[model samples]
Target chain A: MNLDLRLDTSGDFYARKFQPTKREDTLILNMGPQHPSTHGVLRIILEIDGEYILRAEPVLGYIHRMHEKMAEVMSYPQYLPNPARTDYLHGLAWNWAHVAAVERLMGLEVPERAEYIRVITCELNRITSHLLWWGAYLLDLGAFTPIMYAFDDRERIQDILQRITGSRLTYCYYRFGGVSNDIDDRFIEETRKQCSRMKPRFKMFKDLVTDNFILRKRVEEIGEIPADTCRKYGATGPVLRGSGVPYDVRRAEPYSVYDRFDFNIPSYDTCDAMGRYLVRMDEMQESIKIIEQALDTLPEGDYIMPKAPKKPKPPAGDVYFALEGARGKIGFHLVSDGDKSPYRLKLRAPGFSNLSLFSEVSEGVLIADAVSILGSLDLVIP
Target chain B: MSEENAKPEKAPDKEKEVKKKEEPQVPKYTGYDYDCFLAPQELLKAVTKLDHADFFLEDVSCVDMQEGFQVVYHFDRFSQPGRVVLRVMISRENPEIPSIYDIFPGAAWHERECFDFFGVRFTGHPNLIPLLLDPEHQGPPPLLKEETALKDLNQLYPDRVHTPVSPDSEEFVKEINNCSNQKSRNQS
Candidate 1:
């Protein structure tokens, strides 16, 4: 066997193609398809003049699995587990979006109890997602101890979710008309216990990290994205809320039992990295509130619809369903041709939109602040 | 630069704008509040109307239908939440459409994804290279349906009307403007 292992000194295809301006002083740098702070396989090509970045372009598709193509070939039920893989941190939201889109198209009615369960589990999942982000983001900024505290809470939620969903991450718990498994009395008791425990932990987190002078200086006013820029780029979730839009998909477009819950959409007008940090921190508390409310108002009924189709063949038409995932708005656009499988399914990953604005926001900021801005975005590159 | 030159140019443009009014079909079955079909040329104008109306672009997606390539653009507002889907049908032989990148800026990646999947050319896109596929891969676009598997617009849409609305029409402008004010499906 002949092995041609000659090193290409010029650069890879993406690097060579990402031509810098005709300036002798500027240098092109690749941040990572492997860099630690990126948190996943995200490569950012940057043109920097000394420490300040002149231009930044994110090169994607390193981990593209073509889930859309998978949906085309698979049946409705067969495609259930695919959405969860897109954003593993907030898998239930993606699962909900996929199932809810199909259910809306078929006009299947979900029992009230099922809606409450979805709300509780999904909110719990949201907290875990935020917790992981909080820890990983702080770790990216060179802090390690916060992740320990974050995981303590995260593992508990994962254990609770693992029992019902059968997996800690990338959960496929939601079904067409309802969830796959019903919650028992022990599940409720554990969730209530966790929610109560989380309240004081948040206060500790604030005093320990959020209000710390060093952490505040590192994050505050680092990446200032105006509200108008957020709208222009279609950035959502905390990224948009951090810019002070308060445009949560839950309140803006109510889905499931979100409207029934009384919770505040925490927003900051600072339009900086600290604003985003604070929003996520406050949002975890709101999730606890939502879970507590749902638990108190838990109704009794079937978890999954009795007549739910095993192999759903929705009528010929299309439906668009969106939900508030931890990252942002997770949308599923399903087109049916009166077949067991979707004719064409498109996923609107909110991280894609949120990250798109990075190129614009990262310009003129120092390289370290670029990492801060990226961390503040809390991206889960699927 | 003179008013006289602008007057003659504006006259014929006004005359050409006197096309028949077409009302967008509000199909209650679909989750969209307003669903309209537009000629490829009118996409930018319609998108500009949406931008002025304070609607944010959700995502731009494309579907390969037997009739043509249907490029779908989903938009929603923060203040008043309602989904408005714009469907532009372009010929399969030349699957080209005007890019909304200059207006939304976020459609750049979505258009590239469409190009990578279905080989749809987004004209005026600053960077139209492959976004989520291997740049060196040599094969046909992956998402194109087999000829036998193709379904026409009627088969996919069924009962919905497919009339192409003129972007310059008063009714079209009004519909785009009022789409957000209309109560969302969940609220109704």
Candidate 2:
């Protein structure tokens, strides 16, 4: 097998070395830092001999921002903006996780209308995140046009989301107990219109990318992480679903008014990157179904009811809260010593687990095939 | 529970306290077994129980207390709502803890950044390298020190001081200064 291995010496980089007595005759090569396959900034130092080979070690912390430590200093309200930075592609979803966490701690109830609005916006954000992944993953496979086509529709959703949230990336919209502000009638109408428009795009996505001969050849049986291993690694979101695990935070955990809405947690038994790609694409369609349901059943009430404290102080207890973020289960564990600032805050990011499987799946695959596998994983950020 | 334990034996009260603690331990969702939250304070011991585990070391920053530093360890379980947190208090003289990277292997960078910003040292970290800060800076002990606001951060970051000198003009001035110094030396 032909391998396009490029050595990056710009930084102090190292790979896992094996001794003759320990493990003999294994060739290793670096995969990314700038490799187009690694979705965002990630460098996986792989140890392989020829096409069929060995161990893979992932070097991380290139994108580490001490988000937890930073939360300790910032007030409960002040720390709202930073969660968006963790996974910027799905910034809205991260924001919702933090807000949901704080709301649960303070014992604040989100109104029916607010819950509907939250579900609608979150579902829209989910579809948009998935749409970008669809485009970017194809680009990783060396197909260029689909990215442009996917982005064109994704921007329409961005425009709608941006009006209420402000700023394209790193949205701080969902506040404690409710949203920062209510979406106007125009926002609601446009969202309903967007859902109708997205259904046909899903069919088109299936026709264009899913059924393509080249795409199938590249993804069919490549980069497979078995269901047992996926469970062992604590994989969530599409990564888990691709392994035929029917565990979704929305369905299983039931955050917000998700239990009220009807949707299926789609899974595939294939357990490859292609399975992951297909599952996410199908999830976007499911998200559209959810948004349509939410729009029709949106209740009539005040968006921001006054249950939340103006100067909130969470009691001295531990609370674990999570939401079905675009990437997966984005959760926060807040330990409050009855202070305005959280005593300790831990964020369980999906990309961290999803990306961790790279070393396992990328072993033995060719350089190009490795990129395809990484692309199929659809890691947003770690 | 500690309060009741301190008091003389009260069987009923002790049982109630144990029940209160166990309620939160139960999985928030039905039909799912989330028994991972019941582990003791040793963080690494809890992580090693599961195979192929991915430790998401979210953040490691210290809090400034009037007396000493309170080191917080936030543990998030991927299974369910049992996100466990463990904390250790360290003195102002020396703040240290055994690194979790041996178990997780991915926490090396998170621990280093924690050391960089807060000066909370991870004792067994393989590479305690500095990240996202100047290598040579005569600043306070750590960026998050109590004296930060009072001190001028720019003075510590002298590389921030610049005049944007033009290369062409700088060379021209160098030649002129060399000629003038030659003339003065010859005359002397």
Candidate 3:
């Protein structure tokens, strides 16, 4: 029962792959497909010389459910609930992107009311996403109380969303032509109360967290990524906005009723962890503004289109539809051959692009600051 | 198209010399920057051109069509936002295309993901390994179709115009040189 054989065999696959690269002074660290700060099933392989990181490579595919394959196999309507699973926090935006892609291909006309409903509900979901990122990111940097404050507001918003969406996290409220249910007066009233309620909370957040000296020191100038680096890696959403190029798909490639709404795309040229942090905080307020404007001009019409195809067979062609999700630009590339099932369905997750830039930015940084930078990316590792 | 749309190619970031609007039959995909089919040899050239024009690679997607693998590279610009979809067809026998990772470092993972699902080899890719697929898992690529399930390119892209492109010209030669000289092709 000597321990030599067992210890040698017990090293996992990543550990085995990393062994050949080991040098005299440098250390290789495998940081979680399970570590709490990772936010999801993502593992980063780090080559470090003492505390400073020499090189870092994020190895993905841990929770690879093969969602793209599922899209090809499932019928048009049967694939509705699956997209939400990719980015659970901003579920509605993914839902809308998928539905909108199919709608564009099939030429289904969505009612004006349905478009407004999508706008209102999607903004509420965006707030929940940013709030979670805010708390979890702060928690990663060694703060705990902020998460409680975040979840407190997050739960109230989820309650309002769950009333119509019928689920708390992974939502499937959107259909091909329109939404599953229409927004009632109670829903609008509750949302208005919640929106007004969140304004003061954001102010409280600024005083309690943003303005704190220690937190500012942790995030302020750490991991500065210039605008040039952002373009090369194709990083989008707040990560791109934080670098000072105002490219929001809602504004850039205006899809749905987003064109009609008036809301600023918040960006900061500081290009550090604090820049990304500030961007999300301001974006949540902007989401509230969009939701309010949408509610004010909510039209009276059918919730779902009358002639929306139950089993859609789009004419032979393909389309690429993108929308502004909370994380970034969520794109759907669908190819059809006039079939009930899609020939090819490629999902362009924003997290994928945002995460790609990590290896380049993480070099020459302290291990702890690397964690702050990763957290600021707000990755939900789809 | 209006005067505004007509001058997209004449914009400072773009070159008016090689606007290859040769395939008049190709229908623009409404909102996109228009589609172009290129030879595998020309794939790297086109990518380099786009990279020099400040267009960033969005994603590298592969579709298993009848003719071969349709390797679609999507790119967009910050200064002028529009999707430039470059579709290159590879033979079914050997699904290989030159990697754009040297031009766009972000394409590394995407190329691996494409390879893992479609068995499409990205030549010159630094570490071409399975991305989403587990290494221990034993089976053919999940997305590859059997012979019976395969559909022809014409059926998949009914609106596609496939006029044969002319041979390599001096204009393209200078375009490739400009991209290579200006941006240092990424090593990893």
Best by lDDT: 1
* Residue lDDT tens for model 1, A28-58: 8999999999878999999999999989999
Question: Considering chain A alone, what is the TM-score of candidate 3?
Answer: 0.96
Model 2 has an lDDT value of: 0.66
TM-score of chain A of 2: 0.93
lDDT of 2 by residue, B1-188 (tens): 88877676677788986575444322222111121211123444544532223323333434544334545444333333223233444666777677776665445555665677667787888767564344443565443546332222122111222222222344423422232212332343
Candidate numbers, best DockQ first, in rank order: 1, 3, 2
Query: Which pairs in model 3 have colliding backbones?
Result: none
Query: Residue A259 of candidate 3: its Cα lDDT?
Result: 79
Which ranges of candidate 2 are over 4 A from the true structure?
A: A1-28, A48-53, B1-188
Number of the top TM-score candidate: 1
**Predicted structure with the largest DockQ when compared to the true one:** 1
Q: A303, model 1: CA deviation in Å?
A: 0.6
**What TM-score goes with each of the models?**
0.93, 0.72, 0.90
Q: What is the DockQ for all candidates, taken in turn?
A: 0.33, 0.02, 0.27
RMSD after CA superposition, every candidate: 10.8, 19.9, 10.2
Give the residue spans of candidate 1 off by over 4 A: A1-7, B1-29, B181-188
Binned by DockQ into CAPRI classes (incorrect, acceptable, medium, high), candidate 2 is incorrect
